[model samples]
Target: ASFSHSQYEATISWPQIVAALANNLYLGPQLGIDEDSGYPIFNADPGRLFTPLTRAEYDSIAQRTVYHPQSQSDTLAFTFSNLDLFQLPAGAAGFAGVVEYGYQSYDLKPDPLATQYYYYSWKDSDGSGSRNRWAAAGELRMPLLDSLSLSVAGRYDDYRFAGNSADKFTYSAGIEWRPLESLLVRSSYGTAFRAPDLHYVYSGVGNDETGGTDYYRCRTEEPDEDLTDCSYSDEGLIRTRSGNRALGPETSTSWTAGFVFSPRENFDVSIDYFNIDMRNQVQDLSTDRLLQLEANCRIGSDVNGNPVDVSSPSCIDAIARINRLANGNLYGITVNPVNVARERTSGVDLSAHYRLATGIGDFRFSGNYTWTREHLFQQYTGDADVDEFQVNSGFDIPRNKASASVSWEKNAWTVTLHGDRLGRLPNSDSYDQIVDTEAGEEAWIGATYRYNLSTEYRFNERMRLSFAVTNLFDKMPPKDPSYPSSPYYDGSWFDSMGRSYYVQLTTRFGGGPL
Candidate 1:
């Protein structure tokens, strides 16, 4: 059995706690666990495992303890996962359950990214906000109709935000049927949701700072406790913390229908169509939309043909910062949101596999492909550009992406090959949604290979491993300088982490069972 337990309390200023207990804050020699709060505090910077702290010891962070360091945005998130089973009754199905709980409490911060200088000093009471969620679910599998199997799962979550709480329900049902020796059909449907994160609702102005300009944000929304009145702005866009007390959870409904065909052990194929529709999608107001709303809110010509104001500039500016309203035309280019809208996402998953045994002794190979077409079914109508992928033509989708892998295994040796092939699809930016046409990037292929040998004897297990490379064919990412540049985004999307290779050894201890 595996079990875990955690005890955490919200401390408004954890940085101060670290400062107060650099070496040993509690238990007379042990660090952290203040006399009253009894919580752990870190004073040192935890250097990256992959990226070591490049700079030499600096006076500013000298007191930071390597073992324990304070996070800019403090959080106490707990995760617990475990699985145990009751042997199924030989001819009867059995049951199992899973449970999880998470909690986080953070302090208020102001002008986080330096995006805006000093608007309303983001303020909060010590430990004024917290989040707690619990999920419990059970599953039961019952054999049916000789070659058919059925399973049902149900789950529920209880959430608390800013002292207020609510409940959410989700469930799933699935059925697998084999009508013939070579064919099988499967179907399932479920409900899903996304709760506003402490980061999204309460962590006001964060890394919203952009270099060339005053602000850099994922969405064009002003930072504030209320999300309705902000806009994404450059000159005046200031960073303020976000904290919404009454926001509800975003919701969605989804389903999948698929079929499989396997005539022989060497060949198997499957196709699945999946759909997901979400309501009240949590997204930032785009600078473009904010500007339109500020100047004129003409969503898509009204039912009756007439010029309509896209958004209210005055209304958008009042919620977050006062400094951003300086320019009249600025609102045309800026965006922010205190009361943003909702969005939707839907797509399909397609795949097939073929395996073969060759002269290489028990050679094994396989491949899979997926096609997803998404769209924006947001609260507002000006989502034309938002739904870029021409996928469904609705804005929130991406051209489909596919991936496949093949491998061979015999005795103690295993060799595998794989690659990701992005379809030459359209982009969110240009008149030509086709990736190959736009300068953003073109669909390219990347492949890799791994060879490993393993043998076990006595109480010891070991293996030798080597890797071929990424983009096996030296398939470089697409780069077209002709693509235009925008003040907010340059077309310099990161190329794939170029091809790479490595080798290593693996070891394992002998187990009690044989």
Candidate 2:
């Protein structure tokens, strides 16, 4: 029931230096609806509709019914990459160094009311820009010895949120060692910070079509005044960004260690473990968190019923949904992500491959398996709802995820297959619930085949033709509605390609070689 539309214009201003650097600017107007095609015909609430919304009425609602973007934006960007080799000492473990950098800025024309679905009522009284970010980074690799290698990289970025901004600094380091011809080991540790994207930190957008969440009352104690969305149980009655600013970027400290073992030229096995702990994780009160907030902002009472308002309304609903973590917050002060004490994560990956030669042809295959475990560490409610939640209020992180593929190539023909699996996500947003995302992922397989047909016609030349069929089986991906939670998944490849075909023909430039 969701739809989106975008109109774009791109201008490239590259000169003969084009071979060295390519630069361009993209301008476009975009708008989209990320919700279902209106409300469910059978699920509409009759109480709120003074007049009930009939099935016909619901069906009449249009999907992606947003206005064309009247405000335009331009992303000015370009990349310049080139490498030159410089050998170390003559017979020394030969090594070369490389350096590259890229920069881009997303600028949008001023449009205060730029929003999705033309959702504007006199009630919505704010305007902001389309979100964008700018970044620059560089990296270098060096062979320190015949059996050792090292690499270093760094990046600095600035995220623009309307008139405000946030800065980011990231770095990475790695080294490899080969103690013997057949035994190799490598390890690395680095830190990186992820800036909040447009989807979350900027372009503030909210919907209350459903009364699943509650709001805070930072400025009001009265019942009839314009309290600025402090409602506990009303839909479309509260808002969080009415006077709010964008949030800051989150930071992460990460490290990885792994080794590769190649017993034979045709077979190899490897394993890697990674751990990352993010601080000031940039999570906010989405519908799900808002629901949790109700519980957070609630008021606990004693046997005499002494009234004590809870931190906020989010806690009440969240505790309820999560299988009851008790009626009130044991922690007296309201807890929030920004105010959030901290967040951490850890995981491991295992991948292997084997190849064999047979009279009929050649056979080879590979695969990777992963395991993950996450913790909100700072806040583990003894009474928290673990089974019903996929994400904690402070983070949207999966402890583990893995994907694998197996394939064989024989002459001109080849067959391949791949599959990815995701474990149960923790503390998911309510959107996850509405979309039914607990289902995880479906196993999918795709195969492509290429054939070469050539016939000799000259002394030493022949015409050759090649053709390929992609997604030959057309196996549609699992619709389990859980797992990856992506909007695109019909037949795999994530909107890139479906079952399709292609062909091409070629001959020697001088038509003299076979």
Q: Estimate each model's TM-score.
A: 0.59, 0.53
Full-model lDDT for every candidate: 0.47, 0.46
Per-prediction CA RMSD (Å): 13.5, 14.8
Q: Report the C-alpha lDDT of model 1 over 65-115, residue by residue, as the tens digit.
A: 111112222223333323323333334565667676666555443213222
- The digit string of per-residue lDDT tens for model 2 on 49-97 reads 4656565544333122222223344445444433434555422232232
Top of the candidates by lDDT: 1
Ten contiguous residues minimizing lDDT sum, candidate 1: 64-73
Q: Positional deviation of 212 in candidate 1, in angstroms?
A: 11
lDDT of 1 at 59: 30
* Global CA lDDT computed for model 1: 0.47
